[model samples]
Structures are given as C-alpha cells and as structure tokens.
Target: MVGLLVLAAFLTLADRWAVLYAEHRAADALKDRLKLTAAPEVEIDGFPFLPQFVDGRLGSVKVTVPDVSADRITLASVSATARDITLDGDGPTSVHGARVPELNGDVLLSFADLNRELGASQVTFTGEGRDRVLARGTLPVAGHDLRLRADVRIGRAGDQGIATTIGGMRLDVGDLATYRPGARASEGLHLTPKSVTRLARETRKVRALLGVPSVVRRMGVPDATVREALRNDDKLAALTGSRDFVHQAMRVNLLDLTLAHPEVLDRLGLDPALLDALSRLTRPVLADQLSLGFRLPEPERGELWLRDVRVEKGGIRVRLAGQGLAFGD
Candidate 1:
C-alpha cells in the first residue's frame, strides 16, 4: 500500500509538469501565429493531464492578449475561450499543429485608452445606454474653444467592423447661440427665445447694431431715426423692443445672413475665420471625428469576425467569434 501511494504521488507531479510544458509551448506558438507583440497567457482546463495528452485533445483553452492595434484605434484587451481543440502530435514537447473547432472572444476598447488615443479635440466618450454613448468636450475653432456634445449610437457596420452614428451634435458659441452643423445654411446657428431677449438688452450689442449703417438701412429705419436712437437710450431701447423684430431675429438663418452680408460678422464681433471654420464643420465631417468604426485584422489560419457591439461602463465591447482556427498546419 505504501508503494502504491508513492507511485501515485510521482504520477501527480509528472502530470502537472506535462500541463505546464504544454501551456508554455502553446503560448509561444500562439504568439507567433497571431503576430502578437507578446506571448498571450494560455491555460488549458479539465486537468488530470495525461489522459487528455494521450488522446491529443484539450476540452477548453483560454487566451488573453493586450494592446492589439486595429486600424485607427487600439483595443485595450482581447480575451477568448477556445473549445474542442485537437492537437496533432504525440506529446506536448513534439506538438506541431492544433485545430480549434470554435471560439468566442470579447474585444474591449476602454474609455481611458480611447481618451488617450482618439480624443484629439479633448473629447471623451462615455456609455449612455446599452446601445449608445455620449461624447462631450471642446473643439478649437478659429482661436476660440467651442464646447461640443453629441449622442452616438453603437452598431455593427459589417461582418467585422464596429461603427458609431452621431446624432444631435451641438456646439455652443459662448452666450450667443448653439450652432447646429449641416450641409446647408438653412440649418445653422439657432438662438433660443431667452438668448434673443438677452441680446436685445445688451448695450454693447445694441450699439454694435447701430454702428452698422447698412444694417440700419436694410431694417428700413431712416438714417435720421438711427442717429436719434444712437444718442437717446430710451429711443434705442424702444427701437429694439418691438415684438416683430425679436421674433424675426430669432428665426433668422445666421449662416445665410452672414454669407449675404459679410459685415454682419464684423458687427457681431465674430471673426470671419469662425465662419470659415463652421463651413468646414458640416454634419458628415463632424461625425467622422467621433466615428469608432474599425475592422479586425484577418488571421492567416482561420475565420474571425465581429458578432455584435455593446456599450458598457468600461467602453465599447465588440463580440467576436471564430471557427476552424488552426496553427502551424
């Protein structure tokens, strides 16, 4: 009985040694096969190694790799579980090839890493709902820092691409108004009722309007009436206090107005460069900045594709699947 117990202990140690050696070999092989920057951590499950080794099959294997660069973005980490792995050699040390019947993985794009990599405009992304994310930050435009907020939807673009659709992107132009970028001037700067009312009360703004004689003339106010209002505070207030003027001002297409009368920008203390910048920030261009679309690199040995996308607290997670994966075959 004592002799049997000693033999059992020896077998157990030998079994453990075999598993470790196999794991090391598998890690190195995968690193080379996947072209990974470093060897991934590999673990084979369902121990009592000798039987599985003899049969040349591993029931389950887990692999994790970090900092995988995919297109313009970097995946924080990628983890996968491969199942029904069939080894093609007599033993661990002599193993030359293997086949994975099925595998599922998760590619995590952590917000911290995203902020460091894709946050060129100081914009940062955060998960909004199960399928959406919110981007908020500042964009530099013509020497002024403009605040921006956007709602983005997460979805699969193709079999292996994850994409973002931006909606309701707004840029704040100080206290003047919110700019809604678009393909045409009809969808330009918009002023809320409160902003319109506030503008009517600002003395400097009222003075600036009076300073532009052409604008006064276009408003159908005679030069004498404008001169009189320029001297008397009550006259100027009465002239700007009319309901029709305030209502029309709120509905004015600032972009069209500025394009038609370039002097309007000067009168409003806005640089012409600001308009040039806004012209280039159309809907599509702005959306491109927040686009998270990326395609996974095709592996040399097997089929891999993106399955789904989800917005999680950590970041955007894209589900991946693979089949018939083989190494060194």
Candidate 2:
C-alpha cells in the first residue's frame, strides 16, 4: 500500500509538470496571437491532476496579462478565469483547446500609468495618500512657462465615464528676480494668463499690455476687442512700476486654461512650451478606448467576462468569473 501511494504521488507530480509544460506552449501561441509585449502568467487550478490529465479536462485556468498598452494608455493587467475546460481527448500527450463554461475577469488601469503616458518630460504624478493623485508640471502663462502644480480629483463625467478636474492652481517663478525687483535682473513682463484678457484672440492684447509688441488683429472683430498692449501703455508702465529687471525678461506664463487653439502659438510672451502643452492634449489619444471596459468572448472556447475595474498606485488588479467552456481537437 505504501509503495502504491508513492507511485501515485509521483504520477500526480509528473502529471502537473506535463500540464504546466503544455500550458507554457499554449501561452506562447497566445502571445503570438495577441501580439503581446510579454507572455502572460497562466495557471491551472486545483491539484492531484492525474485523473484530470487522463480525462483531458481541467477544472479551471487563470491567465494574467500584466500590461496591455492599447494606445497611449496602458492598462495594468487583464485577467481571465476559464471554468470546466474540456480538452482534446485525442491529444493525451498535450491538452489542446478547451470548451469553457463561462469566464469573467477585470482590467485595471491606475492613475500612475496615466502620468507615465504623460511622458517623462511632463510632470510626475504622486499618490495623495487618500484616493487621489498629485501632479506638478510647467504651465504656459502669458506665453511663458511657469512652474505649476494641480491636484487631480476623481469624478464621473456623466456618460463620458471617469473624469478629472484641476485644483490648487498656482504659478510661480523660480528666480526671485523674475518677480522680485533687482534680485537677479530679468527681462520682459512675467505675467500669467489671468493678467491678460479672458478671450483667445485677446492673447494679442496681452502683449500690448506688457508694452512688448503689436499684432494684426484678425478679420471681422471690433478694434477694442483686439486692442494691443500699447493701448494699455499706461497700464503697462504701471505694471513695471519698480519691478526691476523683470521688465527685461518679457516672458509670460499661461496657467490653468480650459482651451487654446494651436494657431495662437506664435503669440509673444507665450512660451513655445505652450506648443507642447496644447499639442500634448490635442493630438488625439486613445484614452477613450482605455477607459472603456473590454470583453473577450472566446479566449478559450468560452466567454471571459470583464466586469469591474479598480485603479491603484502603479497598476490595477482584477477579479474574474467564467462559464460554458468547450474544448475540441
């Protein structure tokens, strides 16, 4: 009886290895099919597999794809669980194909990944300790790039899915001389968007106020609407007052803005950096598809259901459920 037990144990262990080896091969095939950057983690659930191996069936199988970057956005992971998988009975040496009952899983995408997609040159994102994210980056103000940081609060955007809002809008100069009088001696008027007119075309009016340069107002508008800073000459002088070399810097930073067309990039006092800021968000990212949930109907001859998604830290974790799996040669 003891010898028989030893033989059974060995057979079970060997059977498990065989199943794992076969799974590795299948995962390789899956990798090719999905065009994955890396092969996913695969596991067969339960133990003492000799019986299941002989029958060419599996109780359940789990698969995890660590990172799925559909476009600019990267989902942390996508997991699926297959239940009651029926394998090709003819492939005794290798379990090929399966009939699944029902499969369910989750796809997780976190805020950190979003920041990563923002690019290394952009701001770095940090966790706010409570379910929130903090990001700091240079903002374009008055055509100048100013140091700015914003707290992105999570909120739902009606039918648009999850959304974010900017908070704690603050823009500052690194050199005291830029804002402080006679400290290091800067050039031009270092102003923010708020210092200028509230309208887009009015961007030209900002330069007029700084006493920098003039602009040819676009067609079909009131002259007063497109008035140059020279019109605000008195106000421009008042703006300088005693603010030392700052008058020489002539750079303006635009901050906390809702919208600006790329056409206004050539406007002065506007940091060319605004090009990055405007283009970065406007280039048409695949963010919509990333935010949208996904479902794989026949991953393994069964439907793998993707139900819920939760974002955390650098990655996401998902739970899976499955059904109606059928395996054939």
Candidate 3:
C-alpha cells in the first residue's frame, strides 16, 4: 500500500514538471513565430499531460498577448483559446508545425489606450450601449476648440476588421458669452435640430432677445406687440411660447443669418470678421476630423475573422475566431 502511494506521488510531480516544460517551450515557439515583442502567456488545459504528449494532441490551450500594435489602434489585450491542437513532431521542443482545429478569442481595445492613440483631436470613447460607443470631445472649429459629440456604431469590417460608423454628430456652442463678450446670445445658437426645441423652452433667453430693440426689429416683431408683452406677463409668455416664434427661431441657421442679416450678429455683439471662419466649417470637414475606421492584420495560414463586437464600459471588445490555424510550417 505504501509503495503504491509513493508511486502515485512521483507520477503527479512528473506530470506537473512535464507540463511546465511544455508550457515554456510553447510560449517561446509562439513568441518567435508570431514576431511578438514579449512571449505570450500559455496554458495547456486538461492535464495529466504526459499521455497527451505521447498522443501528440492537446485538448485545449489558451494564449494571451498584451499591447499588440495594429493599423490605427493598439490592441490592449489579444487572447485566444485553441482546441484539438495536433502537434507535427514527437516533442514540444522538436515540433516544427501544428494545427488548431478550432480557435476562439477576443481583442480588447481599452478606452485608455484608444484615448492615448487617437488623442490628436482630443476625442474620448465611452460605451453608449451594447453595440454603440459615444465619442465626446473637443474639435477645432473657427480657430477655437468646440465641443462635439457623436454616436459611433461598431460592426465587423469585412472578415477580419472592426469598423465604426459615426451615426450622428452635433456641435454645441459652449459658453455663448465667449463670442458675445459681456452678454450671451439670447438665440442660444447651437448647430442641431434638437437645440431648436430646447431654445423654445428657454423663455428667459427669448425674453432677453425680445428686450433688445435691435433684435426685435431684425426679427420683424411689431413695436405694439413688444409694448403689450412688456405690460402683460402672460402676453410676453405667449409671444415666446408661440409656435410661429419657435418655428422662426428653428429656421434661423446661423450661417444663413450671418450672410443675410448682419443686424442679428449686431444684437449678439459678434464681429462679422468671424463669419469667414464659421463658413470654412462644413459637415464633411468635421466628419473627416472624427474619422475612426481601422482594419485588422491578416493571418499567415488558414482563416481568421471577427465574429462579433460589443461596447464595454472601459472600451470595445471584438470577438475573434479561426479555423485550421497552422503555425511554424
């Protein structure tokens, strides 16, 4: 009984030793074959590995590599699990080739790394939902940094790449006082349809604009109506709350107003010199500055592809899969 127990202990230790040796050798092989800067962490699962070693088949193996530089972004982590690995040679050190019948993994693009790599425009990425990311940051506009926000949808780019589409973009006119000096733009100038609805609810700002004789004159509000609004609070509220007022305000595209009515800018205390700078900012130029498209590197053998993508709180995760993956041939 004692002899059997001792033999069992010896076998256990031997098995552990062999597994470690195999894992180290496999890691080195991967590092060299993949041209990796550092050796990847390798784990051979489903052990009592000696018998599997003899049969030249590993049931499962997991590999994790960090900080892999890609086309436009650096992948924070690249991990994969290979199944039914068939070795081409008798031993781990002697193996010159191998076959992976199935492989699955994910590449993580951490927001921290992405913010660092794509920091040229000072844009930052955050998860908006399961399949979408929110990109919010400052963009250069009219010789000043302006706030911009966009919802980016992530999807498979062809077979092996991950693609991003900017669904909608809006620029917010932060600190209206900056443009108007001592006063604020009562029109609440922002570049989107949604802002038009918001401007209607801001009765105080509308009142301020109506208070200015120049603004009321440029907007074609009657002098009698202004006098009635001043005496009757309800009338003042009704005038600003009117659908016609909202519609007209919504139609006041700053670009068109800048060209057609210099009086409007006068009420807002803006210099006409800034009109040229605003004119240069177009939808295409903003879209190009916020461009976020990239492709994955091709594999040397068999097939590799992106299966799915999800936006996580910290970053984006891309599911990857491959079949009949060959190494060291």
Q: TM-scores, in order shown?
A: 0.83, 0.55, 0.70
lDDT of each model, Cα atoms only? Answer: 0.80, 0.50, 0.72
Model 2 CA lDDT for position 69: 70
Better of 1 and 3 by TM-score: 1
Evaluate model 2: give its TM-score. Answer: 0.55
- Quote the positional error of residue 233 for candidate 1 in Å: 9.0
Worst 10 residues of 3 by lDDT: 177-186
Clashing pairs in 3: none
How should the candidates be ordered by TM-score, best one leading? 1, 3, 2
Among these predicted structures, which one has the highest TM-score?
Answer: 1
- Per-residue CA lDDT of model 2 for 37-142, tens digit only, reads 9999888787766577577777978888888874556777877777777776466775556676667666666657666776343656665644455666764434
Give the worst 10-residue stretch by lDDT in candidate 1: 248-257
Which residue pairs of candidate 1 clash? Answer: none
Model 2, CA-based lDDT: 0.50
> RMSD, model 3, all Cα superposed?
7.2
